[model samples]
Target chain A: MKSILLATTTFREAVRDRVFGLVAAFGLLLVLSTVIISPLTVGARGKIVTDIGLASISLFSLLMVLFVGSGMVHKEIDRRTIMTILSKPISRLDYLLGKYLGLWATLFVMMAAMTLIFACACALTEAEWKPTYLVALGMALCEMTVVTAVVVFFSSFTTPVLTSLFTLATFIVGHAIGDLERFAMVTGSAGMERAADISRFVLPNLDLFNVRNAVVHDLPVHSEHVVWAVVYALLYSAVLLAISDLLFRRREFK
Target chain B: MMTVLELRSVSKSYRSDFLFRRMPALTDVTFDVAAGETFAYLGHNGAGKTTTIKSLLGLIRVDAGNIRVFGHAPGTMAAKRRLGYLPENPYFYDHLTAREFLHLAARLNDMNRSDAKHRADQLLALVKMDHKANVRLRNFSKGMLQRVGLAQALIGDPELLVLDEPMGGLDPVGRYEVRRILEELKSRGKTLFMSSHILADVETLADRAAILNGGTLRRLVDLHELGHQERIMDLKFTQLSEAMVGELVRRGYPVERRAEAHHVLVEEHFAMAGLIDELVRSGSRLLRAAPHRVSLEEIFLREVERDVGQTPEDLLHRTVDELVGATSVKEESTP
Candidate 1:
């Protein structure tokens, strides 16, 4: 119950940032840019518009995770407000979960707004809504769930500059899980392969959540795939949050 | 009396730099706040006053000590539920209005919406913030924030209220208002463990106080005891002859012979009666006799400047013994 309260307040607070609004506006501009796509070839035009719109929604949400989500914990500590909140009957775990859920709410709103814009863009560009868009958008929120957890995890221990750097690095590595494996094999080093192997078990395969191509081509995305992706998102986010709670639990607010 | 808050051998150390050298923030601090008493935690800057309060509320873990609130370990849910806390230079969720913030605090205390709203209304009015209920906290002045902060601390109406520098940023009016609210809380049988460098307000509200110096417990002063301590009688009288004046000065009273009236400073109340009798017998007209009480400010300064090199164990035992003695004194003195 307390976690939900923290989440609501956090959502309200994050939404007040101008960076959040402008990022959404920029994503809209990117989505609406697809409206001017050449319509002579409907199949090619649909694929192009779908590709651009889904990516725009994904980009917008990631940006929200990057700028706004990274500061949730730090802001409270910097302002010394966490002293009162934690001094109350709330546990550190509850506080961390509230922060994660709060960012999720903000991302959900941003994704919803971007998806609505993408839908209009899809309609305008003759790239009619396939049920796949929801799957693709759902997967996008899922991917950001893991990424938001990453932001939250980093924000738990470090400054914003270091958090942003580490989160951006993690985002790159998460998406390149395939490349990491290939490089692990191509390089004949045993230690590199072992490290890659460990990361494979630890880092979320964010690549799996990218059904945008299948989504853009109007291909059928199996329900089992979405379910597994969600399972992965939930489990990965849990691990990150657990580790975050461990770090934050020991933190002394000096 | 029930012990509402207890800290035994509490110490905290911080990492100073990349070198990771440890600097003690609180060293062997020991004190207990009894239920229904306003216990002032006094110190100069860097004297670990906030560190001690944080340890009490479990905001920070102490390195080598134990703290309990209402018999529960510090920062436990059981502990937290029984107490409210306001930190130094309080900055709440500025994004929330005064009303919304109060509601949030109430809900966090596990109140349902309707109850939270009802309680928030009472608190808003109690803090005299009803007119600005909808006004955002970011728009509030420092004093306004302190007022609302106090009201928020009262939201749960917990058994104990731990406040850090509650009157630090307030104007005189704000200070008086907060002091009055704290006095009311005390009258209602609430335990208040407040930390402050501001001595004047502590003098008015605290029943007993513990002073810290360089992160060490230097003195635990029963203001009742401290108030009576070193109390002097300033006696004004007509000058006596040289022989009588020599007798008075030789007897250890400080006699200042002014042009119109002479003054004799009697060091103790027991000494005053005899000195006055002697002056009357010696053909001196007594003009006035006023009692001067030593303030907490003076004691606080002396405490911080005094080098207390006792070990943590010694400080702990001394605190417990002094507490027992003070309790007996209080019991004996109370009508």
Candidate 2:
């Protein structure tokens, strides 16, 4: 109950933030930018429109998660508002989870808005209403969930500036984990190979959520892969949230 | 009466970058607030008052000790349900109006929707914030914010209200309004554990106060005792001559001769009978005698200076300088 109250409050505050307004505005502009840019494609205007629209949504969502989510906890601490909230009946874990869910809800709203605009753009461009676009968007949302968790985790203990930097680094590294493994196999150095192997397990495999190419090229993505992606995103997010809760629990607000 | 809150031998230390040199924020601090009593925790800056409050609220874990709120460990849901806290320099969600903020606090305490709304209204009225209830907190003045903060603290109808500098950042009228609200809370039998540097407010509101200095409990003052204990006695007499004054001064009384009367400052334990006898024998007419106790401010300064190894005059000077600096900064930001 307390968590719900906190989450509601967090969502309200986040939506009211000027950064959210700016992000939404920029996201819409990016979606519409595809309208102007797609006609320049020589053959596949529909493909170009859907592809850019999905990528635009993914990129803007990641930007929102990285910049806005990074400050969710740090701002509370900096402004000393966390003291009042935590002093209530709510536990630190509840507060952390509430913030995560609240930001996630905001991300959901952003995704829905951008997807609607993207679908409209596709229809205007006479693009086929493929189920693959929705799948790609769903996976994109999952990717954002993972990234938001990473942002919250870093925001729990570090400054917003450092959290933004660290979360961005994590997102890049998470996506590259598969390539890192391949690179490690090609390298002859034992230490490099061992380090790469360890990172593959430690860092999240964000590549699982990247079904954009399959969707854009009209290739079939297996339901099993989608299930695994969902499971991995949920599990990875839970671990990050647990670590955030631990750090937040031990934190002393001076 | 029940003990609403207790802190037993609580100590906390913060580690700096310097190796093996921990800064002690609180050391062996122990005190308790009885049910329905207004307990003031007094200290200067860095005197561990805030640290103790945070420890009791479980915002920070103690290095060694125990804290119980309503006989349960603090930070537990059961205890927190009965606790409402107003932090110093409170920063609320600026996007929220006063009513929404209070409702949020009420719901977090598990109040039903209708009850939360009712209580928020009641508290807003109690703090005289009903007029601004619909305004966003970002547009509020400091005093308005403090009032709304107080309203939120009272939203749950908490049995214990832990306020850290509740009157901070308020003007004189705002402070008076806050004190009146606290007085009302006291009348309703709410236990108040307040930490404040405002000695006048403490003297006016607190039943008992504990002074902390240098991370240690310096003195616990029972204001009730001041009504019975005489600290200083003022004696007035007429027809006081220079020779009589000399005699009185020689007899160890601090006598200041006025044109119409002679004023004698007597120690609390001085022999009043002997002094009167002397006055009568000297044919000086007695005017009046009165006893006075030292003010809370005086005692606070004495304790703070004693802890810092400075004279009261020096401390007062430094305090004035600091206040001036603070005022200038505030002025710079006023526009």
Candidate 3:
């Protein structure tokens, strides 16, 4: 019960911050830019909008997850508010979970708002709402799980600036997992292949949640595939959160 | 009797630099706060007061010994439920109103929705902050912020309150109000362990005070014993001639002649009663006579200074004995 309240409180506090406004602006501009870029494609207006929307959501969400989520614990400690929270009956794990849930909820709210705007634009322009929009949102939610996990992992025992840098690097590496593995196979270098193998397992394969190609090209998305991706996201989030909780439990409040 | 909190020879050391040797923050510091007692933990800056508080709260792990707060480990939730703590410099969510912040704290302490709201209201009102309950805490004055902090600490109606400098930044009026509230808590049979450098407030408010310096327990002043010092009798009369002074001196009284008046100091407190009666009977004019006791501030300063270079173990025991003796002195000197 306490952890839930803590999580809710964190969510409320984050919404009041300036980053939420900036992320919203970025989301809105991305959606408008898609509208302008749509006419430039031949026989692929739908594909163009889908590509732009997916990329825009990923970019903005990564920023929210990396920058905003990364600062959740740091700000609490920096402001000395953790002392007040921990002085109560709450445990360190509960506080950490609260922080994770709070930032995750904030990201959800931001993504939900941007998704609705993008959906509205797609509907008005095409004169029909695509069911793929819901699928895209579901994929976006799964992707957030991984993004939030990475942010949380970096946030543990690291500064906000450093965490942001590392999380962004992880995001880039996560997106290149397939390419790196393919490159390693082609290069036939044992060391590089071993590095690629380790990187694939260690980093989040954000590409798994990258459903733009399927949604834009009108390709079929299997139910089992979506389920598998959701499961991976959930497991990844739990692992990262567990690690974060461990690091945070030992951290002395300043 | 169950001790509300006990620190059994706890010690903590902090390394000065990443590569340097460790500096002891507390050395074999031990004390217990029983239920319903106000224990004043006093010390100057760099003293072990804050370290002790942190150890009790389990914020800093002790290098040696044990601490039992309410019969449970300090960091355990079971013990924490019965404890309310106010950090020295309390930090709260700036965007949250006083009421919201306290309510949030209450909820986190496992108070149900309605109970949390009612308790938050009662606490805010108790701190005289009900008027500003709706105002964002960031805009609050320091005193108001401290009051809100105090209210938050009291959310669970904690059995033991560990206040670290709760009165530090408050104005005189705020300090008095806080003292009054603490006394009221004491009346309710709650244990309070408060830390502060303001000796006067500690002297006035604490039932028993333990002083520390350089992470060592210098003294444990039982104010009850310290209060035993008697109010001395002082008599002022018109200046007496040398012969008159000599005559009065022969009466077994300590008489000193001043330029304008004569001071008659008596060791026997009731001597005032006898002298006053004799003076009236003899038709002698009585200028003024009054009783006074030395302030605790004087004793605290003197004792602390005297024990500056003493070992922690000896200092603790000596101060405890002196406190007992001081109280007996008060009881003896009262007439």
Best by DockQ: 2
lDDT of each: 0.82, 0.82, 0.77
Provide a comma-separated list of chain B TM-scores, one per candidate: 0.78, 0.80, 0.74
Q: Model 2: runs farther than 4 Å from truth?
A: A19-24, A27-40, A126-129, B18-20, B227-230, B235-266, B269-289, B310-335
DockQ values, each candidate? 0.64, 0.77, 0.47
Worst 10 residues of 2 chain B by lDDT: B325-334
Which ranges of candidate 3 are over 4 A from the true structure?
A: A31-47, A124-129, B227-335
Give per-model TM-scores.
0.86, 0.88, 0.81
Choose 1 or 2, whichever is better by DockQ.
2
Interface RMSD for candidates 1 onward, in order? 1.0, 1.0, 1.4
CAPRI accuracy category, model 1: medium
By TM-score, the best candidate is 2
